[model samples]
Target chain A: MTLAQWSFDLLLAGGLLWLGWQALFEKRRFSAVVHFMAFNLLMALVWVRLSAPDIALAEAAIGAGVTGALLLTALGRLPSGTSSGAHPHRWHPHWRYLAVISACISTAWLIAVVPQLPSPGLAGEIEAVMPATGVDHAVTAVLLNIRALDTLLEVAVMLAAVVLVWSLGPTLRPLPPATILPGLPALSRLLHPLFLLVPTYLLWRGTHAPGGAFPAGAVLGAGGVLMLLADEVGWMQRQHWQRLLRLLLVSGLALFVLVGLGGLLMTGTFLSIPLGVARLLIMAVEIAMALSIALMLMALYLYGEPGQ
Target chain B: MSDYYATVAALLCGMAVIGLFRAHDLLHRILALNVLASAVFLLLVTLARTESGTDPVPHVMVLTGIVVAVSTTAAALALTIRAYERRRQREDER
Candidate 1:
């Protein structure tokens, strides 16, 4: 690598390390969180540097946006104070030498191996079958068509997580609305349409671009959390809406399974979308996955299941 | 170039592991855990870069990972906050 390039990478790596240190060890809770968000933002840059814009978008949205919101919300609810009360385990005197020796050995091994590692992946194989997948973007094709079984299980995991959270019941003892911030209604109003508009755009973009269900769903989930945080989604707690919400949450997996079974009936294999209808079917699956993912993430952000 | 990122990612993993153990509480530990996750992602993506072209599979895998990581973090935070709130309420009563 050129000196300039090496310098830049070193600087970026150093920045990440510094930010990580501050985030983990900073005496103040609020500042640590802020530092952590900054680290995620920097990580988005690193993703781009590695030529993975899809991951950069996902990292920026879910890692920085949704996760930052969750940490902040949790911070507000939990007992807030400076960080002097807790204590770390008092390591045995001999532990330090062991830790240092292991650290040195691992570092040496990583340095030796990382530089000589050959680039190996399925790029060629995926490229060969890209057209059959019917998505213009190879990444989308892989996620929605090629390895869709993984996607299927991922949605199930999300469903399980939301169920786990809901089982906790509502732990958030509702505080007064004034505790959140000023001009809250306007912020929520402003963000509502943008959230809707952006995710739809992202959904469309995913067919040929770095956008996909994860990023779109992440933005949608952010909007949901915003609405809930603003306490504007009180209507969701109503009986009629609860059914709709539950349906929205499950529609992804249910529809995905049905489509997979349809593939079985038509092609003698599950999840194998027929070529003639691959594009349309992939779109349908993408939309379903996006919706389910969005709601699942939104559900996870809730203090607990609403209307419990 | 890939080597540079790989080395950085390795160092990051080291730091995050140290921080994860050293962290005083669940919140701090969770943040370190996120950093550790990011380090692993960096390493995987860095390895995807070849003389030919970047791989889509690793990118897809990392995207899925990000979603899973966030969900698990949310679940963990939800549980931790619950316990903290309950403990605080008891302290207030006492």
Candidate 2:
């Protein structure tokens, strides 16, 4: 790498480290939140530096945007009277700390040894067949085709998490309006239209670009969370839409499973849909999954209770 | 050239980890975690760039990691907020 590249890397790393340290050492909860936001933005820069534009987009939106918003909201809900000073008792117990230290040491040792491990001979074989899958991106091929079962299971896990949160209780408990921020209503109204369009664009672009269903869904879910915070969805309206959302939530998984099973009938293998049909099927599944994930995330965020 | 840059990046990762360990508040811990994650991504990208032929595998992995991280963060934040709300309610009851 050129000197410029080396310096840039150093600067990025230094910035990240500084933010991390500040976040952990900071005494004030509010300052910690700010540091966390800065850390996330730096992480996004790291993604860009890594040449992963898709990841950068998702990290910026979901990591910095939605996660920060949620943290701040949570902090706002905290009792104002709680002592904000140092609480030594809050730290993990000595045995717990020792256990964590051992775990970290082992993990570091494993990672250090990874580079010395022998490479599998099948890497070339996997690469050779990648182009035939109609996806140029090997990672995409792995996720959407070669090992789609794992991806399917991941989606199921997300759904299960939503369900777990939902079952907790009535998440729509009316807090005293005192916690609502000023001008949130106007802000939500202005951003609502853009929210609807951006996710669709992201989803569509995933076919040829770095964007995909997961990021798009998270962005849409963030928008939904914003609407909820602004109280834009009244109790009755939320209840009315809940039923529709329930269907969309499962539609993606249903499509994926059905298409995979259908392929078995014709091709004698699970998820073996033809290349031409696979693209269409994958896109359809992504869209359905996006919708489902978005709704599920929004519900999870708003309800603050998992398993329903 | 890439080796030099990678060395710097690796050092930064060490610093970020130290910060994460030192942080006392939840928000700070999250921030430190993000920093740690950034370092990992940087290392991966640097490794990818060192290849004689540009391979998109690292790029794809980074993208997937980003999405997963965000989803995990969103859920974690929701839980945090819920916990805070509960604590507040309990305090009021007392």
Candidate 3:
């Protein structure tokens, strides 16, 4: 690498370490969250340095964006008077020192073994079969075709998460409400149309490029969150609407399983799509997965039945 | 060069463990767990980079992991909030 490139990488590494330290040692929980979000954005840049744009997009969009929103929501729900950041014992916890020592030892052990790790592992193998999977992107092929069972189960896990969150009971509303969109019509107008196009574009681009279902679903879910934040009477408030939302939450997993079963009947193995029409099958599954994943994420943000 | 990145990733992991151990609040613990997950993802992506090109398999694995991490975080936060509300309600009744 050139001097410039090496310096950039060093900068990213330094930034990540410093930000992580700030996030952990900060006195206030809010500042820690801010540092953590900054750390995530930097990590996405590190992924790009490592030549993995797909991971970079997911890291930035979901890891930083959606997760930050979730953390802030939880932070808002905590008792305001509790001083949640203040620990009774200001002194460093002794066990934490021990934990750090153990972690360092393990990290040393990992470093010793990392040099021996094989390279080009499963990439050539996956790439060779990419044509059969009907996706130009090798990552998509692995996710939606070759190792699709894992993806199917992941969808199920997300569905279960929504169900679990729903059981927690009702939306935690901020008093006075945060529907500030009326004050900023320009911001609302810009976001409203952009949300629609971005998700669709990301989904469409997934077949060939770094963008895919996860980021698309995340973007869609973020839009849902923005809508929820805008008004007191949110989208999922009605009793009848709750039933439909629940169905939408599970629809992705249901469609994935049904498709897998169909694939099994067509071929000998589970989730094995025939070589013919692989593109059609994969796209259909992705669309269903994106829609369901979007609803599941949004439902998690809403957290239980929408309060009246 | 990749090894350098990997070392940083490992150190981040160490930081995460320490943060989790020291953090008293549920939200703090969750944040540390997220830092830990990001460390693991960084390690995998860095390792997947080869002399030829990057591996796609690990990329997908990390992508799946990111989604799973968000889902679990949401569930944990919901539970934390619910417990807090329940305790406050009980105190009010008393």
Candidate 2 per-residue lDDT, tens place, B59-82, comes to 555555554554565555555555
lDDT (tens digit, per residue) of candidate 3 on A180-211: 44654445456878877887998899889977
Off by over 4 Å in 2: A1-6, A79-127, A136-139, A172-183, A235-237, A305-308, B1-62, B74-94
User: What is the per-residue lDDT of model 1 for residues A170-255, given as tens digits with 9 covering 90 to 100?
Assistant: 63657224376767778999989999999899989998988878888888887887777777877667666888899989998998
Q: Lowest-lDDT window of 10 residues in candidate 3 chain A?
A: A175-184
Residue B33 C-alpha lDDT in model 1:
94
* DockQ for candidate 2: 0.33
C-alpha displacement of A294 in model 1, angstroms? 1.7
**Each model's DockQ score:** 0.64, 0.33, 0.63
Model 3, residue A153: displacement in angstroms?
0.6
RMSD in Å for all candidates: 2.4, 4.7, 2.7
For candidate 1, give the docking quality class from DockQ.
medium
In model 2 chain A, the worst 10-residue window by lDDT is: A114-123
Encode model 2's per-residue lDDT on A245-276: one tens digit a residue. Answer: 67777887888899889889978999887876
**Better DockQ candidate (2, 3):** 3
